[model samples]
Target: MSEAPWWRGAVTYQIYPRSFMDTDGDGVGDLPGIIDRLDYVASLGVDAIWISPFFRSPMADFGYDIADYREVDPLFGNNDDFDHLLAKAHSLGLKVMIDQVLSHTSVEHAWFRQSRESRDNPKADWYVWADAREDGTPPNNWLSLFGGCAWQWEPRRGQYYLHNFLTSQPDLNYHNPDVRRAVLDEVKFWLDKGVDGLRLDAINFCFHDQQLRDNPPKPEDKRVGRGFSPDNPYAFQYHYYNNTRPENIAFLEDLRALMDQYHQVAAIGEISSEDSLATTAEYTRDGRLHMGYSFELLTDDFSAAYIRSTVQNLEAQMLEGWPCWAISNHDVARVLTRWGNGDASPQLANLLSAMVCSLRGSVCVYQGEELGLTEAEVPFEALQDPYGITFWPTFKGRDGCRTPMPWNNGINAGFSVGEPWLPVPAEHRALAVSLQESEPGSALHRFRAFMAWRRTQPALRLGDIRFLDTPEPVLAFTRRHGDETVLAAFNLSAQPVELPLDGIAGATPVNGHGLAQGTFADGRLSLPGHGALYARID
Candidate 1:
């Protein structure tokens, strides 16, 4: 275990820079602010920090719509600030990873600007431009993930450009050798900056079917299980042609080749497609990427069986590829509320953290999760996400999760002196970092204590997981590595439960982990509500 790569089983803390902290009081968090909070991030005892996009952008989809890959947006300070942040994070023993949105770029990007100018410009065909059908409709029936057709008309070019997301974010044509070369060079710009890793955003969307074939209609019953809701038109189709094309394999190899040149640099791609699990397996196989995470674990399924099946499915397919799991992120509602089931508690939060971390893979823990922050309620009047504005009451986009972080109980939860980009809910203020830090029994303290303790257990970190058969609301597994075997079990509900360890070998309860402890005696295991048990098999 000591010889394993630093990222093999690391717990990465995902920091949403726009909501992390606002040092300049511009109502948005900046790189300098992240740098200032590096100490606090270090205190969490995480192995790495994955900062969401800070690249220059027009804020069309926040920083996802990048106008320039090489420049840091003035809203987030210049390259100097990022350099300082990186240096400080390294000094604090935190590996730094930045979001790399390669599949698309903002409409304002110079390449897109020139490409949209005319059909034969120097940068023409830099993006996915297709002629409209005879009826003047979009070339195909493909739908944008942000609603409406994926194509946007350009009067200057007399053609439509593809945007898998918002209209302002144009998809790059990876088929174009020049475009691929340019994007690779842009990525190299970061590698040159000494970044330890890259969190690839929508990496599977890099290529579209060259023929632009229409996607097949999906069965209504199958639509909701994926990341999108039933209300989203995007879930109506199987989405075969628009993304996760065969061509992406080669490009990922090229990316991996470039990364191989650097020392211990890693890449973890975010994948969403028709079969995200299969694609996650393929993308991480054969040295394509260091690790890959799909939206499978990020969904609203809180059932113990679902979690077991999801991990087992991937484990069966991803023989050679490493996997990364996340329960929450800048996108989607926070896992606490999504999985809380009406009655949630600090004990439940601690159990959830332990459960996800104990899974057989590296983990990404979202910011404010240490304090067990639930989803915020951002009103329509204060909403900034265009996706939410487009899909009102039914689907509230990701603003609830992207609201400014609560650092303290002071005004605006100490996120900023100015009005926050999204209003912080009064509920979040009560669980602010400062308040949690003062109370040793708080979620924050337990999380830190667990993380610190987790480091001492090598089997929990890199051990191979074998799930044991148990009834609902109880998840039991054994982690085996080297000559050591550790048994872990969790109660996934707010009510007490008892299960028999029938035919199981003797186990001595391993204490020191900060969750509610369970009892193991006479081959019977008793767990309190939201309780977890860890034992070393004798």
Candidate 2:
């Protein structure tokens, strides 16, 4: 048997630390809470767990704005708590991948603090700083992903610093060799502590256009940001100068060289750019990132053609690099609610899980996804996400998806004794883990069954995929590896569909998996609403 790396075709469960579980009665989940639920995570039969940021931060952008790379935030826990979580996860045969935000740091970060104090400081060039224009305007027309201008003025230095997301988070200058070395050293600290891998946050934004050129205005017809609403002005430009710079490739190469020293450690980058698919291909190619995932699949477009086109486009561009697929994550709304037209059904959730896993790459399943959780309704009063608050009513932001995970149908959904950071939706409580555990046909049970069975199928685990021509709402693909060929198909709509199975001969049905099994007869396959099938082609 070939010794493939552990991350290849692996399934990673994403745990948003703030909403996963809370044990300290502080209304916020912590490292100890994660450790307490290691058994529950392991029970899902996932290959790994990718924890979102828990590093020392001011919580400006929740944990994205890092105040210190080496220290754990008191809100999450201390370093010892992290060590214990890592050890416990490993003991359960689960690889642990922590989120690493390398592009920017919280303004409260010591490096940023010193850099902003004066121009001649030792760390003055550590961050991207520039003088204002002669007219006293920002250095360029760059816009922050959150809102307004990307430049934040610092009176102490009499200059403006670039902030792609929030003013509290200043973008670092990779042009400075010292900055690169320092960030790499911080990453090395985690590797030394035996982290299995890293899920690099905003990896493409590490290096900005040094010339401070203004980004060209995007055509009105092309104003759609990947994951943002059209109302946000950030989508009005091409974003060429602010992010996705060509210089980022070299830094990735340097980071990859450092990781190569460690045994079996991997890096997966999160790419969000004007052309994220192309950027994903570039970052993962040539010994940079082991894997790359974009927001292509996470968008609200839930059509068979869109999914096929996105995967095929990436496959064509990603020459020798691997791809990771995720339907939902911390930044986006829950897939069921987003794609189901407001109907969150067990069938839709189960079908999505199977469909994404059957694709030609590794996969990530967000927490609460197993229980068919929909997007929680966070009213304006309860809103905590700045992104949503900034664009209220028009775009409610990510807090709905980041609400506390429902463990039981009790007060606070058994997430915490005290109030949660975000309110748990009553609808989520209806589909709690406790309630689903007892029901054999629940989404949670079906998810576990499908994942367990997926591990046994080598073709699905690691195989070449070829999409078969099918009509609307029906997707068909075949996976083949070493004389083993498996055919998988799904109906991505609410109505039943009939598909003609051409070129498929003598296929043996695979059973006992809790998917909505479709029937094949007389060269015609009949699939019910949200139906799916997996078979071995003899």
Candidate 3:
């Protein structure tokens, strides 16, 4: 237990602060609210918690538009509250990892302000600003993820500033060394506050083509959502110049060097690239990021083949680098609702949890996942996400899955005394923490038990996966480590299936959840519908 690397086989829970909980009846979750629930978070058996931004912002994109790097937003409390939360989390034996949005900052940030003002200030080159063409058009043909042109004209500076997302979050000019040093100093500010690690937001987008070259148009059919909208034209471009530049590698090396100064301090980058697989491998290779995760499993597709191919591709390319796997997060829909048929079963939830834990890389479990909570419906008027508002009907955006966490059956699910910023789903109340605490077989209890059990299986934790040839609705794999082997089989369909086990080997089920049991004889193992089995093979 003491021998594993800090990140390998670790389970991290992501907390979207605004919806997690709220103290002081402010309707928005704050640092104090998180501190109050430190014990409850630790009881879930997660190794660490990745809290989304609580820095000062204009709330245009919630806290993602960071206005100030050092000060805590008054909406979320001050620096003292953050320090208190850190101490409380560490006291409960839980690690704290803050989200760092180095790629961009709020247009209102002091650096952006100084950069936009007069253009001769010391911070003039801090943000990506370039002169417009003679016709007053943008400098280049780059589109913003929030729709329209990625560059916005600043009348005072007589230039266009680049914004990958909202115009409020202007992209930083990473080509400038002064900007890099300033960003690192902000990183040091959090490290000095005793955070164990950092979750680098949109890490690859930190640097772009300094020449401002036009991104070649990609075929409409060849687009995928690396992070932004897949259906939008933003995805229709190759994005060769906007992100994942060669300049990012040296900055990553500098970042790694800084983290190496502390014991067990790690950094995981959120890689959103047109060539995400190649970039994920490169960003994590050697001494770059400690790990990087892409949108491989966070899509609408859900099949045994897709899952197998994604993992196999990473295994072939990543080699020595580490990967982090996540099915649902703040930006994506809940897997049960997005991938599963509308009527999601508790059995499938248990199966998905087991599957993610069995993967070779680390895992991130979003809040309310333990309850097997599916996506909730938020009325158009109640939708706070700008992305959803802009692309209504066709794509409702991420608000459905970003609802308030259910803590009790009481009003507002006990997330706050006042009305929560996001509405709590009526269906989620029955699966509240208070109700699940009393039920022995509840998903919440099963999550804790299964996580504890997973810690004991070294084959599942650090072993290589060998996919077995199997029929539809059946996913089989063997995790092997130096003569020790474990066979994991899943009946993906709603009907029974029999798996043939060839060669000389013995097996026994490592029961966690009360999944179906099968008897094996003459190299054949019989399984029932919605069944799964993990066996110690000898």
Candidate 4:
């Protein structure tokens, strides 16, 4: 297949800057550090890299709490360092996408700072602020994802400010036209800086109810993890008033308009809505966002039924929109441990890699995913994530997944000589990049080979996915592009499974990784546990 589109079927590597690779002696990974490692990232055969937030922040929610949108955080270096990274990545023929958190900003951001100073400040209405009730309670019953009430009482203004996350990360009043304009300006700044795209953080949270109305209680079974744990009271109520407002449509249109100005500059919005897949479809439809992904497949469930249901649901829900699928990200638990049984087998890792790429949408592979890294265990004393600290042991928030990327078996995994910001997993030493580089059958090597092979399949690249009627433990599907069809089948169980291939006959194996070898006869194929088979259908 000739290259269809820059984003169509392209694999994006998500790099959590603080944990990726530190070029300097500093504990944190900076833009210059990323520049130094661009060649390594490019060698993985990924089309692009999506760097997590490195914006100026107080590190309240790590870098998600943005203090400045146009400026790079000092810990990650200055503008020149970022420019150098962009240049180096482009030189390596890799597209660059920066994380843009438009939903909120750090309490220290100039706009929020001025807004909280007084009711009469020029930027007073910039953030979502409301007067407390006569009883001194918050204006609404909205809950924060980080825990407790979403509103934080600001004594200086004698009112509670809206914050869906940490109080330090106050929600922006997107209802205001000026706020929309300013956000668009921030997007333009990155596009002008030669960023090929943006990974919009919490894109669904950009708007809220205009009136200071209390959100209604959610029904007993309606709640699922958005950011807060189900045990937390924050998940008890419907988030109707706090986020995913109808007003967000226009803002998305505004965002899309700006992106359209530059050729091949794409925007992938992160739809963290209650019904994420539906919202993902809605957000990407009608030229709102180029593409968007939800948390449907990011959860702990690893089953053929769950995966098939999600893809089918999206196929049904999303018609004109494009989707981006990711099994692992910075915040979520690493997929290896999350989905892996006790063995933590390489066969399972290869299956996941193949499954993710075979989906119709674009794919995002996190930094250490190629190495099959599991979540690092962080003790309470060593906890760096404020979210994890707040709900210790019960939830133990995102820090487990944010550990330093293991580069080698050497001290600190070659991440930093000056002690890594977070401890590297001891179990990860054997799976380090240095060690994996030497092993041909390693997960890293499998990832490289799979991605290389994927580039050759038109059906896997831009075709539509059609599920075949197969029995339990077997997932059979066809990815078809015009007349070229690739029949892909996977045995998701630990025992052998025989799956029938009806109607279409004459299938031959293409020698995919970890698949059981068998000849096709009488329109049937035999597969072993954790096996996969790919063939070009005639």
Each prediction's Cα lDDT score? Answer: 0.92, 0.92, 0.85, 0.85
Q: What is residue 277's positional error in candidate 1, in angstroms? A: 0.8
* Regions of candidate 2 where Cα sits further than 4 Å from its true position: none
lDDT of 4: 0.85
In model 2, the clashing pairs are none
TM-score between model 3 and native: 0.97
Q: Which ten residues in a row have the lowest lDDT in candidate 4?
A: 512-521
TM-score of each: 0.99, 0.99, 0.97, 0.97
> CA shift at 232, candidate 3, in angstroms?
1.7
TM-score of 2: 0.99
How do the candidates rank by lDDT, highest first? 2, 1, 4, 3
lDDT of 1: 0.92
What CA RMSD would you report for each candidate? Answer: 0.9, 1.0, 1.6, 1.5
> Model 1, 272-341: lDDT tens per residue?
8878889999999977999998889788888989999999999999999989999999888888999997
Residue 508 Cα positional deviation in candidate 3, in Å, after optimal superposition: 2.3
